[model samples]
Target: MTMVLCIGHPERSPVLPLHPGARYYAAPSPVGTPGGDGTRGRPWDLATALAGGRGGSMVQPGDTIWLLGGVYPGRFDGTLTGTSAAPIVVRQYPGERATIDGNLHVHGAHTVYWGFEITQSNPVPNANDALETYGPDCKFINLVVHDAGKQGMSFWEDEGTSELYGSIFYNNGTHENFDHGVYAASEGGEKWIVDNIVFDNLAYGIHVYVGSRHPFLSNVHVRGNTAFNTGAISRDGFQNANLLIGGDVRTEHMSADSNLLYFPGTTGRNLRLGMPRGDNRDILVRGNYVAGGAVTLLMNGWAQAEVVDNEFIGAGTIVDLTARGGSIVAHAWHGNTYVRDPGARAWRYEGAAYELATWQKITGLGNTGATGTTPMTPRVFVRPNKYEPGRATIIVYNWGHQPTVSADVSSAIHAGTRYELRNVQALLGPPVLSGTYGGGAIEIPMAGVDPPRPVGRTGPTPALARTGPVFDVFILNRTK
Candidate 1:
């Protein structure tokens, strides 16, 4: 009940005129192979150019098919109608290498497309989500969905969907079921924007469920992609967390900034919050830079989230709020930098033992006794002095500039102490700041003991050692 079919057009190459809902079946490239005709010479057999008779066929409604370069496997039942004022385009012309297999159906104002490459190695329940858009305003550009039998790209419950920009969801590793390299079930508002490049998956590389199955998902933008080693949650199914988040009540806005999540394991939680449990407020995770893992950040069951300035290397509880029980409310933790991986597993906020005084302070220690201008800027915050042998010294001066204005002072010493230098020359005006650049004469060998208290809140403790000189305090900010 519609018409207008044209394949391969740069200027004009229309030589198969048979109107009436137009249908031209011929996609040859394999089978005795001798100059296939999809273009230049002999090119047809993408299931008889998009299904057309027993071998597997189905496609009508101004059908415009064109795929020919090489590699065209089999299986593809069709239905690509056009109604949004005429919309149904199956593509592959920029150095074509088309390939599609089984399961791909779009109806009504149909707009099922093709950019090819969906390989499955057994285990075909969801066909590893090799491409789906339940036709609303359907869209897919520069596609490459790899290794599937589970999840690589699945979208249904459409309502004006759009996915532009080169996409590539790889590995999709699944033994049974973890699948999720890119999944979106919009309820209606629709706008699942994934600037793709997901890798090594078994689960949670990009997954979003908007309750009641596709509530037209609102605008969701996951920028500059690269989610490494995705979370494979589900050894036996039931979902445990691997970046699986449910609709924030019905989508309005959800974001993930400057992507790059490395080596994540433990089923999930590189960035997971509220899944199908409903009521998820605005989500905004900023400046990503994660490494290895064991709970980098999991505010499970969210209801108001915002964890900022990220950079947590080799994680182990960078933030794992125990399920936020009791209907979690508004959460906010600023400036993240948890680089404490001393053989892992030490931080636990629930059973106690959690220390983060800005990650154990070391506020610039000083001792400028040679009048480089008296600037022994000391700001020591102490609390670890059980004295197996503890020592403290502070004295810096800048009475008004000195004999050559030399200044240098650094502190943190404890291992059986012995800097034995009754006087190594230079009473202040000889070395204006040397030790190259990391500063000079610095020695930190601590033992002073008693620095492990967080099991039951004995409180008031932090500063076992931090004796100043963070770059030999030299004032010039002028504010005397």
Candidate 2:
């Protein structure tokens, strides 16, 4: 039950919480104002600011709305609109952090939202996410979305153009496999998923699939992303792939390139093109580094494909070009490096298995391909929380069972800054260690520190393997 999207607003304005540009301030609960006047001394409540203005002062385009540093409880729906050039801006106040402990739905166009932490603060029986972008041509920058219910961000196709950039989505979704990190679709303009870190969600990490529901999905470019153990946290059987870009209908002009996909336990599936029984065109899957799994192309019509310079490391079907008995025209396939077991499923074409030599002979593709046994070496994968200057999400890939390793935080935190490190699994608990940064690496204790996994319903903490190739996630916070 969804309503048609409407992108219109009357003065269409917002003001930053930090920068200088017709700024307005809003606080919650105990820090609220009485008969407020949108001033620093007497800030309005969160609701008044979102509703355009109070009494005389109205939030206008190119304006900024500054959210005071505190938790804003309850679900909110913003209907502010802005012009194409003078879009509304909503930001956190100077050094203070703003936390929206409930759902947020933005129905305005040309809005720029920045630097906020979104999660559920209470029991949401129906279980909806805290983010939904129905507005077209908007930007979501540096959002930390975790431990929510259902989908992480419902970027509907109605949002003709939008960008999900420099964000972190993990530990989302319930036990239900229907949820996803980014449940998205597109019909007009571009839906860009760029430079993000998504992991351990219940279902697919970047699910750009609509099945037969939508007419078609197009113009989505997923680039420079790092997704691992996408569907491995909550469910078993390696529930879903790290990235998926297909539907049960028609999809065109999309690409998934320069991304890293890693799942070590079993088949660590990475990027998949075209769902079973769909049609795709002008697709590009290139420059991706995949480990433990492969770049699987399945059940669809790939009218044209450009797969180049991708490195695959695994013992199973590292590269399935035939599209699992679907229709595909792989025009350009070169510079692909395959590091697999000697006699494993390396290449399959026209419903048959073949080595590098035979695969080139029959298909005449992958002529410049090379095969070796050097897999992607395990190490720490770090992604900085770009909008929140001194914060980062790290993944410690302990391939050799190292008890502890020094994790570099110099990039996230410079010298003379105090930092706090915590295991994301035990995120609600105390920090693992806290000290001032000296432009050096932070020693992370891996194998010895096993935090019992947290769950919603009360039950025995499920047992997780802590053996070879153990991967643990951590958060580094720079104390203000």
Candidate 3:
């Protein structure tokens, strides 16, 4: 069946492919009467369209609800359930804007809500989240949630995988309420929080507070987001942070990488990775640029994490390992650059302030330098392609000011295997692969131009070393 697609503000709304046998309903409030059917020509109100009575059929799995441009009030509760293959989609109408001056509650599984603006108009005392989800496999994408009384968005008490992508959560929480920008607490599920911006909250910018209700939170990935100006307000002498991972729970394979966190108003830690009761294992915090906090990173009790290839600039204490409580079995601090104020200690270990030199000598860690400005270290990860069986994708991130010269690929490939690189020129400007792969340890040349510095900087700035180019290498086996 042919459909008429509208186009104006493409990012606010995009044309979605119609699922087979799925029904469509439209809600154009402030213009459409309540008695009309939910058709494109004669749309219904938000309540009638969502409740699905006189103007529309009941919302079912694989259904699509199109919200036209207008201000909608009341909570948009997700009471309808859907499957993984065919999810219930609630999206804005193309070329128009939809604003919800209320809250949202998602109680159903496998649902998606995209491209809307959620804000608080009345400003109630102790107000709930602008968007709160307790369902599994639910996704919130490209939405703006701001100025809430409490958290901007939350994923609480969920046991299923959820995702939040390309969204903005800002200006949330009150002084008394002490809320966060994004508060996530799941029993056990994977969460992908990527490409978002969170700022200007009373508490943390992003918080993962998993309590003792769950055994573990696994595969939690927080990547490529930006957070700034957090914890400006205090609550009962407890200030917030840029990011906080706390609770009486366990975590596995949790990674926070390539994020930009800065400008903390309080003296709280910029990146607090653990709590007094939680056990975090195999956690990786890498390639992040953090600045303007009293403590850059605080590893509390029962945590074994790797702080690698990150730049921590202008902090009182770059790393604090005093509160670890002797529960850290394995921890590594490698290739991290710290630009602190002079005479400020770089680290605090076991209740004693130590410079980088003293700490490195005692623990045999952080061998890079005393000032913590180390050369760029190359990081690579390879995984087999799910769609194409005989191929793999290589991710190479250069965490320095200079371009990466070569990358070791011994662990990724086998000996005597002939492979061809695809999409090499598109990523790094040109193909620069060299040398034969007998594969005990082979190096691949990756010569790319370094990024140009800012125009008016006199000397070397810390911001210049915080970012570099990243390349993706797609490889196909030619031997078979």
Candidate 4:
């Protein structure tokens, strides 16, 4: 389908509202350093500007700091703080792209960072996160971060309530099972992880699992996200879930809704809620689509919950409530579609196998939902890049495992637009398939493309990384 809303540059989106205050600063540094005054012509370096300038201090709470287009290599620590109503703004120069080839640490609170490419071109000592957050009420929007030794972003639990929205993550966690596309944690307050595309990471995507160091997390809302092809390509050959939350710690009531998950060929489950060691108090899993994995809710599952209107499609045991000793209290497990080969064990409740009709009657769930023999057909969503109309991020779901899927881009670009599609997994490699767009459905080649291989994580990878029909994410740009 043609992208209607996300038709603009992925970096500049959720289109920022007008910030008050009549001040602006510039960082036109050729290198990230501490020189130059804060002026458009003589802009200070990124480090200087973020440190509040040289002579005294030039950055205010609501002022805008523009980093002129170019590569800024090195580590950057930002200490600019702002209120919830008015946060400090650090973004790329208009119409120009900036690439940070190191690490970014947000040490202050209430700031809005926009439009930039943050990567780990220079890996840290221990394969740490490319982006680390320490402040609260901050918004890291419309950014692209990848190539980390560990996670792409460490949305820490220090202050909590930070947002990682409208961003893209891939090719990270060269360190192995330890990292993910997003490593989000929260002890309290609401953490918003919304409308982002995370795929092809070395490990799981949008992971909320924690360890013994700090085992208690609460109030995390993961919504409007798409994750696929996780752990398929790895240094250690481990295929993990597309999306997972909860671990060995105590997890509070959380929700996973309106998301898309697919693990086409891998043994990875599309989505997993809670781990075996953790005791989940309450949970809600609704309106999600899963393929090639079961929606398993692990641990002691006699919790207050609602698992409704979701699709769980896998070869066997499409849905496992993780039911423990007793029935789930205050539960609503209906309107959820289950798909499997006929006669395959389709569901498990309290460790007992049951057919769809029997399970529905016994638990009074899936009464409105139906069992399906087929998986979701392949479909594509084209998101136009606002800055350069020739560039766009295309999201493809190849649930049926078709070698090719087609999409119409007439709304985003016109005819005669010579375009090439390259799987994000191999951006440096030649395009997987390319053709001139005639303003109609164009086929995307999806076969033998996936995440990289690595081994450093402590979490368990799939016993065997399943391999099947492969492509999940791609970048579409105009070709000469």
Candidate 5:
């Protein structure tokens, strides 16, 4: 059972690059100072060295324990088992400094890959939890858990489910007395994908529950990471934003992408889904760039979710979904780009009785004129011509909320003109220009223009033709 290859390039397989610093081995290096052999630079200080006494012994799937940097402080129960074919890793030996100061909390049958820092030298009483995996694939990478009072990195997969990357969950115990940073409870599919994590002063950066498809366990990729100045302290406690993918049992692969979420005076519902019950279908809120916090993305009980291509800046009612007892069925929103309180008016598609013709507006083909209806300020480009490769074309200028600057289409553009476009993903009536004549006395010249309200903007009330009436399409760029 020897399969540790993650390193690529020569042709591609490369991904094995988790050596932030130390890698010293000896003492049989398995657990550390096993029978005292302690070699590779003469290492020995795992708690008091000598492998903490090798408690329940097992750790042998390919065995690899490094921990080398500094400060490793108390109350550390032990047992590091492993074997689903070779899976024991306790990292940090590629460079140096791997610390676990106190309260590792173990029960039995192990698999502990605690990388960097697993802090705790002072406060940890409220509930108490610095680390707990009860045993499963058990992996806690690039770790950095702090102040712990409870749930810094708690996972009880029952049998298997544990994988946290780039961790740094801090201050953990104020929100309601500690909620979670990377806490997974375990049920069916048993999953955890906590990626690029970093939650300041606890209350949730990444907390999943019971299992099922385990919400499919998507990236948890809470990107960029930062929950500064925390929820403040609502009379005695605080902590909200940063991320909380709860679960009473609703699995469909939930995902909160490109994160930078923040919560100042917390209350609740930053990115919550209370669980309520089950059927929590495929949730994937994309490219998140949220700011304040009110109800960034929440969907209560009876599940059915899919909020796509997200970019809800500022945050207020970007998404509420509603589900205490009523609405929320077969939910499907498309091409999201809400930006209300972030700086001001920007609601590409606010929710509440929402049904933009079934959502799929991801436009793009070429000749993007009419500027999505004036206002041009929200800039983001890149789609010159690859005929759509993985698809990504954002031209959201005057964006949503029925305000495309007044839809002018710039008098039908003419600066070397040559069009043949069709990249209009919904929100029709403003960006429709046409003209492809070749000969035959095509003397087209209108005086009081008014006759061309049809390009592509289906159902759900797609009939608002009164903004500037100018039309002159045909801006092809295929050169085919």
Candidate 6:
């Protein structure tokens, strides 16, 4: 009975399209000379406005380079190339704050960096990276990469599509030689990585490798982001992990939603998904919110994954699949929610350990049920319907612990259009309303009853309605 559909009024990001041209300026103690002539009151030093010299003065394609506010040492490589609709921005100079103490490569393609701050402390043992791209449709916004002796931002064997929004990778591997805090690998394009904020890294905090002979990392997405205490300093005990998706190549259309993982004393492994020389099909692990971790999700060998609605708090062994071997196709672990620490054993197949009801009866695999704490589910909230233009205002919330007795709602309008059901309220129980409305569907049958539970209520509570479960449906549309 989990039917959540919140449509209209919330998706907005998409308005990048600019092409104006020339405007350069750089200063790390400017005021002319260092091969000045980058105009904007003659500015230029920051490696001569990114090495645009040798008698040609580069940085073309819809230009714009303004890095003005202090500290800007060594390495800036760039090469320039802008063209996915004329990009090549490189910002930071209005309310200033442009610190870049070293490292930043990018080999040339639609660039657009905005709001910088990469601090490569003493790097250079192995060319310590703190931002190294091979170029493609680049777009980093609000970046803040930190102290690195290795990785903090890398897209290495590049190809095309790339974007990392609202970034902030912290503490990065100093001499222990960084492993990742954002590292996308070879082959082709596609990667969005939204809202970012990876923490103390010394190994994986978002690493997507695809080696075993490249090709097949298709369309990655990773949403909302907020990883914590990543691998600390792994000397390779299987490279920790906060979000690692190794590779024998092939990982079509990936997705990691709602992210927010943690790993306190750090032993890492908040989400690992390796094994894909061929079938890792459409992978998706939704609504994440994992905690602490000894192993939050390690589905090593086989993959066709789709773990939904996550919330595995205080993990010690949430799901370990003993290196997975044979007969497990089309995997799915729905609604997820295991609180842990009473004896800690959620799962560990094949080598034996199962807990969530004997691991959902020998792996037909967790069907939406497991909770020792953190399970309130059932929350839908739609809007529009102020004065009716197509009207809509659903709000079903049943903070459960044993309540919801019946619920089967549906949406999707305009087939013949004529739905009408105003303000039906059911604070608790006997509201008798039964389904079938409108042509495009609008079914509803929300009978209720939930309240007892003080140690004297084992099941039914028909009319003692205790004020939990809130309801309100107000749809209306009449346009034949």
The regions of model 6 sitting more than 4 angstroms off are 1-14, 23-33, 39-63, 66-88, 91-101, 104-111, 114-174, 177-179, 183-192, 195-202, 207-221, 224-234, 244-352, 359-366, 369-480
Give the TM-score (vs. native) of candidate 2.
0.81
List TM-scores for all candidates, in order: 0.29, 0.81, 0.68, 0.80, 0.29, 0.32
CA-lDDT, candidates in order: 0.43, 0.69, 0.62, 0.69, 0.42, 0.61
Residue 9 C-alpha lDDT in model 3: 17
Quickly count the clashes in candidate 6: 0
lDDT of 1 by residue, 1-480 (tens): 111111111221121213434333334345313223333344455544444323333444555556554455444534444554444556665445655653344433445364556655443444445555565655554466666666667766455545433355655545444467777665554554433455445556677765554343555655434454453222432133334445646544566654545443333356555554565556676655444456655544555666576655443555554333443336454666566543344344333434454222211111101111112332211111111112212122122222222222222233323332110011112322222223323322111112111111122322221111221111110010
Segments in model 5 whose C-alpha atoms lie over 4 Å from true places? 1-33, 37-51, 54-132, 135-154, 157-183, 186-207, 211-244, 249-259, 262-272, 276-296, 301-317, 326-338, 341-351, 354-480
Off by over 4 Å in 2: 1-19, 33-35, 55-57, 94-97, 121-124, 157-160, 233-237, 293-300, 323-330, 376-398, 403-455, 458-469, 472-480
Candidate 5 TM-score to native: 0.29
Error of 5 at 409 (Å): 47
For model 4, how does the per-residue alpha-carbon lDDT over 274-327 read when each residue is reduced to its tens digit? 777776777778777676653432323636777788766667466666653466
Tell me the lDDT of model 4 at 251. Answer: 82
Among all candidates shown, the one with the greatest TM-score: 2
Full-model lDDT, candidate 3? 0.62
Q: Candidate 6 lDDT (Cα, whole model)? A: 0.61
Cα displacement (Å) at residue 472, model 1:
49
